[model samples]
Structure formats: C-alpha cells, structure tokens
Target: MSTPLRLSTVILPVRRWHEGGRRSWERAEDLGFHAAYSYDHLSWRSFRDTTWFGAIPTLTAAATVTERLRLGTLVTSPNFRHPVTLAKELITLDDISGGRLTLGIGAGGSGFDATALGREAWTPRERADRFAEFVPLLDRLLTEDAVTHRGTHYSADEARNIPGCVQRPRLPFAVAATGPRGMRLAAEYGQAWVTTGDPRLSEAGTPRQSRDAIRDQIERLGKACADLGRDPDTLDKVLLTGFTPDKNDPLRSVDAFVDFAGRHAELGITEIVVHEPVPGTVFAADESVYERIATEALPRLG
Candidate 1:
C-alpha cells in the first residue's frame, strides 16, 4: 500500500529568538504538522544582514519545545561542515530529539554562503562531487563506528562514533536532488527524496504546467531508482511548495492547497512541505491560515 502523504513546513530562523522559535514550533505541533524544519545557511540571500541562528541550535531548541513534531534541516550542505564532526553532531541531536530527526542534505548552492567564510567558491561540478562524497561518508560515520577514510573532498582519520544515534542504523535522510547524480544518490541512500520542483513551474507557468513538471521529475526519479534495483516506492517523494504568503503560495487558499496535494499524490509524491511565514509578527499576524489547514485542507487532502 502507498504510504500516506505527510506534511512538513520550513521556518526560517532569520531575525528570531529562542522564545519566538519555541512558540512557532509548538504552534506547528498543535496544528498537527508532521514535521518542522529550518534552513542551514550562514547568511541567506534576501536577509543577509539580519540576525540568523545556526540550524542545529535552532532545531535543538525546536525539538525540546515540541513533543511530537519531527525536527529537521530543510537542507544542510557541505558548505562549512566536515562530515565527521557533522556526523557526531547529528547523532547527538538524534538522541536529544528521541529519534524524531530527519537529516535533509543537498549540494551546496552558489550564493552568499558559497564565499562567506573565507572559502574559495566551488564550481557546480565540484560541488556535486563534494556532495557525492559527503553523503556516503556521513552515512558510513553514522552507521559504523571507528570510520577512517579519505576522499577527494573530505577525510576522516579513525573517527569514532560512540553512543550512536537513537535511530538504529542511523536517522532517516531526506535528500534534496534535482539532477541525475543527486537523484541516484537519493535512490541509493535516502529515506526521502526532496525537490523544490522545476523553477519553471513557479516562473511563467500555470498550475497545470507546474504539475506536469513535477510528474516529469517523478518519472526521472523512478528510473534512477530502477537503475539501482531499488523500489521507488521505498523513498518518500517530497515536494516543497508555497514560497510566499500571497496568491503565489499554493497554500494561500484551502481549495488550492487541496488540489495541489491531490496532484502530487497522483504523481506519486508521498509528502509535501510548505514554507511558513515569519511567525509571531505582523508578517504572520493571522494564524488563522494555519488553523484552517489543520482543520480543513489537511483532512480533505488525507
């Protein structure tokens, strides 16, 4: 049987505090969201000069405040992480969250974060190769103890993972991949494959065009899984929608949200994540929209 569609939302930690963050996550839990996530970037594009918290610390805080909502990074990357250290940090987080942790990883994108920390900018191909190495090494370090390895992009010498993760054999990975190499890696190792859908879907395209683009991506993922002799059904297909709080947002209306989810289900997507507006402020002054989703749109989608 197909798995039921799961819903998650991303709460960007720009210009926010602990109490505010706690309130936001708690509200999501109360709203019956399956999971909540934060972005892992040093400085995001739009809010480069604003206050921002580290993804891990924010997530740890979120996990502590919420009892049932799963916590995750929208997509953490190798931009500034050493796989070995990152592995240890994630394992500790998994323990703290009592196993309600999902690791969302992606290839480092080019932007402010690419050159912010005195690091040289990497080309697209280089970033892809680094990501390819990072995921497998991280997987090994999380699952096996005393991992020692060397790769083109990273290295670990007798790295020991003691008092391992709460989730056996490592926590679930939600890998973001929109390319062939990334899709294959997701098929081989991720519990979920995540995409923002094709950019064209959001740019100069209608709803039907958006759905068609997603279907094409889904078919590509299926073929990648087949090539690796893995069942595509085993991976949760996650689509990220609703970037803004306007008509552009898929969750802007209850009917539109339901239709969007139904189309994703028809395309074999098992999960959908939306971007939540800044909580506890004028930007997100109306919490009714969220409540409506919990009481109306969500039930219909299910």
Candidate 2:
C-alpha cells in the first residue's frame, strides 16, 4: 500500500518564546500537525535583523509544551554546526520529546549562514564534499557511545554521547537535497527525502512545471536508492511548499489546499509541509484560511 499523506508545518523562529513563540508551537499541536519545524540558521534572508532565535533552543522549548507534535529543523547544515556538539544536543532533545525529533539536514546554501562564522563561503563542490563527511560522522556520533574521527572538514575527538538517543539507533533524518551526491546520502542515511520543487524553475516556471520538476526529482531519488540496494518505497517523500511557483495558493483556502495537495500526493509526495502564516513577511497569508486547510482540508485528503 502507498504511504498515507501527512500534513506538517514550518513555524519560523522570528518571535521570542514569551511573546507568542510558545503559543504558535502549542497551536500547531492543537491543530494536529504531524510535525512542526523551524529554520536552522544564525539568521535568514530579510529577517536577518529581526528577533531570530537559535533553532536548537527554540525546539527544546517547544518540546516541553508539546506532547505529540514532532519537532525538527527544516534543514540544519554544517555551515556553523559541528557534528559532535549537534549529536549531544539531539540526544537530549529526543529524550525530551519522547522520540519525536526528526533531523532535517542539507548541504547549506551560500546565504548569510555561509559567512556568519567569519570564513569564506564554500563553493558548491566544497559544500557537497563537506556534507559527505558530515552526515556519516554525525550518524556514528549519534549511534555510538564514543567516537574519534578525523576527516577533511570535521573531526570528533572521542566525543561521547552516553545514554544516547531515546530513538534507539538514533532519531530520524529528513535529508533535504536536489543533487546526485546529496540524494545518494539521503538514500543511505535518511528516513525521508525532502524537496522544495526546483530553485531554477521557482521564478519563471508555472505550477505544472514545478510539479514536473518534483516528479523528476522523486524519480532520481528512487534510482539513487536502487543503486545503493535500498528500497525507495521505504523513504518518505516530503515537499516543503512556498518555494514552488504556486507559492501561497495552497494556504489560501481549504479547497485550494486540498486540490494542491492532491496533485502532489499523486506524484508520490507522502508529506506536505506548509509555513504557518506570518503577518508581515513573505510567508504572510490569511490566518483563518491556513487553519482551515489544517483542520478541514487534511481530513478531506484522507
């Protein structure tokens, strides 16, 4: 049988926990979202000067207020994070959330995060190379009681994560990728594969073109899994909306979302993650319509 469609959301960490941040998390759980993620960045585009908080701490706090809501980073990267330190924190988060943490990882882009650490930004090839080393080392760090490894980019010196993750081998990894090497890593290490349509087509492409792009991506991901002697069916396909040409159309109304989601679902997307409406930002939308899509549209899909 095909995997059932699941609805999730991304809540930007643009508010203080006291000033409505905590409530957004609670509301997501109350709305019955399967998972709620926040961007893992020192700061993001446009909102760079706003009240951005640390993704780890924001998630840690969310874990306390939520019971069933799975918490995660939309996509964490090696831009400013070290595997050893990240593994230790993830273990704690898993225990706190009762095994509800999904680690969304990626080869980070050349955004503000690239230069925030006082170093030159890595080239595309360099980013891919570093990611190749980062994921495996992180895998070992999370599963093993202690690890010592020296790689081209990162190293762990007998780093220990005793009483490891509550999720047995480790928490699930939702790897975000659109390239070959990255897809291979996803097939090798990810529980799910994530995409945001195609960046190249985001500007001029129509919704149909975006759908076709994602369809092609999913096919490539399957081939990558096959080459690695893994079952592609075992990996969930996640679509993080808003980057597509259709942008916020899916959140405009319950019917619009159901229609938008249905088309993607037909293309083997198992999970659809939308952004929670933010009033004054690019992600802004009608709050009631967003809620209706969650409370009403999802059930219709089922």
Candidate 3:
C-alpha cells in the first residue's frame, strides 16, 4: 500500500535570484500552482549565471505576492548552513508564508558545492544515513515545544525553538531522494517524496526533464515506509514535472494538454509544479518557458 499522492511540482522560480526570481514567482502564483520551488546550488556549471543566492529570501518575496500557494526549496543541501540557523530561517519563512511552507532538503554532493562547503560528498548511503537523522531532528525542533536531541552527526543542548510551525504537525517535508536509501528516508521521515522528472544522460538541457520513472520511485518510497513500521498509505507524496510550453505559440490543442498531464497522472503523479526559467538569467535555453507555462501548462494542470 502507498500513500495517496496528489499534484506537487518544483518549478524553477527564476533563472537566478538576483535577476528575476521574483518576476517568475509572480507567474507561478497567477497560474495557481499548489507549491512553487527553486533549486539550491551555490555554483551551477551548465548555467553559470544562475546561482542560489538563498532560497529563503526568494521564497519570502513570493510570500508577499501570493496567499494560496505553498512555497519550498526543491532541495536545500544540508552541508552549507548550521542546523540551528537553518531551522530558524525556515521557521521565519514559515511565518512569512502564513504557514504555507514545505521544507525540502538533501545533501550537498556536487563536486563544486561539496568542495566549497568543506563537507566531503558522502556516498548515497552515508548521505541517507545523515538525512535520516537530520530530517526527524529538524521536524521535532520545529513541531515540538522543546527538543533534546543527540545523534551521530548532531547534538542539541536542550534546544527550545520559538513559534513552532504554523502548519499542523504535518509541516510538509519533502526529501528529494532518488536512491534506495533516500527512498527509505522519504518513507520514514518525509511528509512527501519530491522528485525531479526523469533526467536524460546528456547534461546539455534544462532541468525540464522527466519520464515515467516517477512510478518506480514512488513504489520504492512506499516500501521504505513499510520497513519502518509505518503505513505507507499514511504519507503524502508530491511529484514535480517540468513543463515547458510555447507561450505565444501555445500547446496547439487542449487535447495535447490533457495528454501531457494524463501521462503523468497515469504514472501515479497527481500534482505537478510548472517551472518557468528566467530568460538571460539562470536558464541558458529560452524565455518561452514562462509564457508557454501560463497559457498551456498551467491552464491544463489547473
């Protein structure tokens, strides 16, 4: 048995924060996306111009413009910031978002980022082990009145976090795990499993890549939860689909739109976040992603 999954997609809020992360966010809100998200990268290779200034700042700016949408970092790495500091920032953003914040996290393992952070890029298993410990600890700190935690990687001395999560106990947490260990973490600790669609081996394109692999990942995620003595069906699942349509050009037909969403739906992906990249900013491709999204993708997904 697996948890009931609904629509959730991580869209590129902006190509780069400094350039137009704010402007892209306005489109996401207008499109009625359930949850909007941005990638966290200190250094980007393919698109050097696009860099992560700070996901929280961009999300905070989004909070001011929209009220109904939920915002999160597609996957913020754990190595860059201290645990307490990260917790505090998320808490503040939680308040700013009016309780519509989902915290998606992962390990920093890219060559450039790992070296820059001074944290060794551990293997998948090691990263999973750390996340398994960290996610729950963070969850407790944000949800409980006070937290006394001690683990292999972190220790807290009678931590008392103020203004606990504004959301219910289920302060949405997305673990963007693509491996087995990550799958287990998502099941045991994550409120939802966040996935970037199927990526091609060729690294020359935008992250607007996806495939039916989501079904397999979702199944793996379910089994992981079951192993932890938890009901897989009790968890929440969100899958992100990168939708790039031609704006002024449009998708040609409504049936085409249905076909696109239906493919994801058939694959057990209920919710999708349409990522629109900022032109001449973070995205090296084209600016049409935004217009195509508003006219074709969002309307159909909505």
Candidate 4:
C-alpha cells in the first residue's frame, strides 16, 4: 500500500504569541494539520528586520495552546547551537508536548546565522563535517543519561540529561538534506527525510525539472539506506513547499495544490508542508485559498 499523504504547515516566527501566533497554531490544529513547524533560525532573510522569535520558545508556547498538533523546527542546525544545550531544550519541549515533537535538523547554511555568532562561516565541506558529528552526538545526548564525546567540530563532557526524551530512544529526527553525506546520515539516524527540491533550480527551473530533481534525491536516499542494510520505505519523505519551482502555485487554489501534491506524491512524498501565508513576504498567498487547500484539497488526496 502507498503511504497516506499528510498535510502540514510552517508558521514563521514573525508574529508575537499574543498578537496572532497563538491563533495561527490553534487554527492549524483545528484545520487538522499533522504537524506545525517554525523556522529554527536566529533571524531569517527579509524577516530579519521584523519581529522574529526563537523557534524553541515559539513551539514551546504553542505546545501549551495545542493538543494534538505535532510541533517542531522546520530544520534546526548546528549553526549557532551546541548538541548539549539543544538536546536539553528539546527534551523539555518533547516532555511538555506529550511526546509530540519532531526535530527537523540540517547541516545549516552560511547566511545570517553563520555569522550572527561573530564567527567566520564554515565552508560547505566544513558544514557537512560538523553536521556528521552533530547528529550522532545529539542522538546520544537525547537517549543517554550522561554523554561524553570529543569530536573535531563539537564536544561534550559528561553532559547529563536527567530524564531523557519523552519519545522512546529520543524524539524523531526529520533530517533535511539533498547531498550524499547528509543522505547517509538521514538513512542511518533519521525517522524522516526532508527536501526542498533543488535550490539551484528554485528560481529558473521548471516544475517538471524540480520533480525530476526530487525523484533523483529520493533514489539517492534509497541507495544510502540500502548501503546501510536499512529499508528506504521506513523513512518518511517530506517536501517543504515554496523552494521548488512550483512556488506559490500550490497555494493559488485548492485544485492547484491537489495537482501539485499529486505529482509529488507519485515521487514518494509522504508529507507536504506549506508555509502559512505571510502577506508582503516571499510566503505571501491568498489565505482563503490556503485554508481551502487544507480543508478541501487534502481530503481529496485520500
């Protein structure tokens, strides 16, 4: 049987909790989204000048107001975070959320976050190297009582997580990657694999090309799993919309999304996460159309 398609949303941390953030999350749950994620960045592009909030605190606050909606970072990174500290926060967040937290992690990018900590940004190779160490160390930190590790990029000494994650063997990791090394990590450690299609083609590529790119990515993920003697089908494939060539087409109307989703679903995507319309920003869309996609289009997928 094919995996059932799940719909989710990413609510950027641009709104203050009292103002509208809380309502957005509550509405997402009411709308029946499988999960609601926020960007785990210190400050994202364009929105950097606005009221950007921290991902951890935002999700933690959302947890209090939500009951069943799974909360998580769209893709947290080691950019300015250490495994030791992040794991502690994640454990608390998971417990508070009643084991309804997923950690969407990646190798991170060299944008604002890379230099926000007052340090030189890492090269692509360096970022990949750090990511390799970050995931395993984080895994151990969330699962073990005390961890001691020494690595080239990060280190922890007898770090203690008194009570481990609420989720057994630690909360699920939805690793974001489109490269070989990263795919290997996802196969080895991730419960889900995330992709945003191809960045190179985000601006100039056609929808067909974007789908082809994702198809290739899924194929690579399968091979990585095969090399590790693991089943590729075991990992959930997630596509975070907007970065693909399809862009806002999926949000233009219910039928557009249904069509866009059906095409990607054929490529093995189990979950599709669309951004909640933030007018005037790159994520701008028709809110009513977006809601229709949630309330109307999703059921049609089944």
When summed lDDT is taken over every stretch of 10 residues in candidate 1, the lowest stretch is 242-251
Candidate 4: what lDDT? Answer: 0.95
Give, for candidate 4, the lowest lDDT window spanning 10 residues.
Answer: 290-299
Computed on alpha carbons, the lDDT of every model, listed in order, comes to 0.82, 0.94, 0.64, 0.95
Q: Model 1: per-residue lDDT, tens digit, 160-188? A: 99878899989999999989999999999
Model 3, span 1-302: residue lDDT tens = 42232333345533465466566677667765566776666655555454446667878888897788788887787656556667878888888889999878876564566667565677766666777777777877787767787799877777777877788774677777778777777787777776655444224433223443566777777778878988765666555543232221123344554566656556566555544544454233334544454456544554
RMSD of each: 2.3, 0.7, 4.7, 0.6
Mark the regions of model 1 whose C-alpha exceeds 4 Å error after superposition: 243-247, 279-286
- TM-score to native of every candidate shown: 0.93, 0.99, 0.79, 0.99
> Candidate 2 at residue 96, lDDT?
89
Top lDDT model: 4
Model 2: how far residue 214 lies from native, Å = 0.4
Q: In model 2, how large is the Cα lDDT of residue 222?
A: 96
Judging by lDDT, tell me the better candidate of 1 and 3: 1
Q: CA lDDT of 66 in candidate 3? A: 78
Candidate 4 lDDT, 1-302, residue by residue in tens: 88999999999999878899899999999989999999999999898888999999999999999999999998999999999999999999999999999999999998999999999999999999999999999999999999999899889999999799989989999999999999999999999999999999999999999999999999999999999999999999999999998888889989889999999999999999999999999999999998888899877987
RMSD of 1: 2.3
TM-score of 3: 0.79
